[model samples]
Target: LAKTTQPISMDSYEGQEVNITCSHNNIATNDYITWYQQFPSQGPRFIIQGYKTKVTNEVASLFIPADRKSSTLSLPRVSLSDTAVYYCLVGVGTGANNLFFGTGTRLTVIP
Candidate 1:
C-alpha cells in the first residue's frame, strides 16, 4: 500500500472552504485513490475516489494527477460538523471490499 501524508491539524472557521491535499507518490496502477472522512468516535465514511484526472461528487471533489501519484480533496463551504479526520487509501483487496485505516489528517473546524 502507498503511504500518504496530510496536515496534522487545520483551523477553519464556520462556512469556510477547506481543501486537504494528500501525497501518495508510490501509488500503484491498480490502486484507486479513495478519500474518507471520519468524525469523532465514528468510522470513516467514503468521500470520493479517482484514478486519474478529476472526479466530483455530492460530498467532495478528488483531483488526481496524470502520473497517478498524488491527489487532493476539496471541501466546499465547510461547517463545524465537517470537522473530522480525512484519510487517503490506495485501494482495498478487490472492488468494494474492506477498508484498511491509516494515519489520516485531523481537521479542526473552529467556530
Candidate 2:
C-alpha cells in the first residue's frame, strides 16, 4: 500500500470552496485514488475516486496530476454541514480490506 499524507485540519467559511490535498509519493501503477468523508460517528462515505486526470460528482471533484503522485478533493460552496474528516485512500481493489487510509484532514466549515 502507498503511504498517504494530508493536512491535520482546515477551516473554511460557509458558501466557500474547500480543497483538501493528499500526497502518495510511492504510488503504484495499479493503485487507484479514492476520497471519503466522515461525519462524527457515521461511517465514511465515498466522495470520489479516480486513476488519472480529473473526475467530478455532484458533491465533489478530484484532481490528479499526470504523475499520479497526489490528488486534491475540491468541495464547492461548502456549508456548515460539510464539516467532517476527509480521508484519502490508495489501493488496487474495491472493498474496505483493499484500501489503505491516511490520518485524514479535519475540515471545519464556519457559518
Candidate 3:
C-alpha cells in the first residue's frame, strides 16, 4: 500500500464535465492505479484502473502516461448528483484487502 495526493476540492455547474487528476509518484511495480467515486454516507465505487497507457470502461476513463507517475479520471456530462469525492488509489493484487481511503478531490456540482 502507498499514498496518493489529490485536490481537496473542485466546483463546477451541473451538467458540466469533471476531470480529477491524482499523483502517485511512489507507485510500485505490482501496484495497480485505480480510481473510485464516493458520495456522502456511501462507499466508494470503482471507476477505472490502468497499469499504463489508457483504460476506459462504462463508468470512466483512466489516462496514464509512460512514467505512471500521474493519472486522470474523466467523467462525462456529470449532473448535480455526481458531486462527490474522487479518490485515486494504489493497491496490491489482493482482492479482499481493505482499501485505505485518503483525502480526495471533492467535486461540487452547482445548479
Clashing pairs in 1: none
TM-score of each: 0.87, 0.94, 0.88
- Estimate the Cα RMSD of every predicted model relative to the unseen true structure: 2.5, 1.7, 2.1
lDDT of 2 at 76: 99
Flag regions of model 2 displaced more than 4 Å. 94-98
The better-scoring model by TM-score among 1 and 2 is 2
- Which is the winner by TM-score between candidate 2 and candidate 3? 2
Highest lDDT, which number? Answer: 2
Of the two candidates 2 and 3, the one with more favorable lDDT, higher being better, is 2
lDDT tens per residue, model 1, 1-111: 566777777888888888888887767677888899888788879898888999999888888889877788889888888989999887655644434345788888888
Candidate 2 has which clashing residue pairs, if any? none
Q: What is the C-alpha lDDT of each candidate?
A: 0.81, 0.93, 0.83
Q: Residue 71 in model 3: shift from native, Å?
A: 0.7
lDDT of 3 by residue, 9-95 (tens): 999987777888888877778778888889999999888888999898987788888888888888888888889999888877674
- Superposed by TM-score, candidate 2 places the C-alpha of residue 103 at a distance from the truth, in angstroms, of 0.5
* lDDT minimum window of 10 residues, candidate 2: 93-102
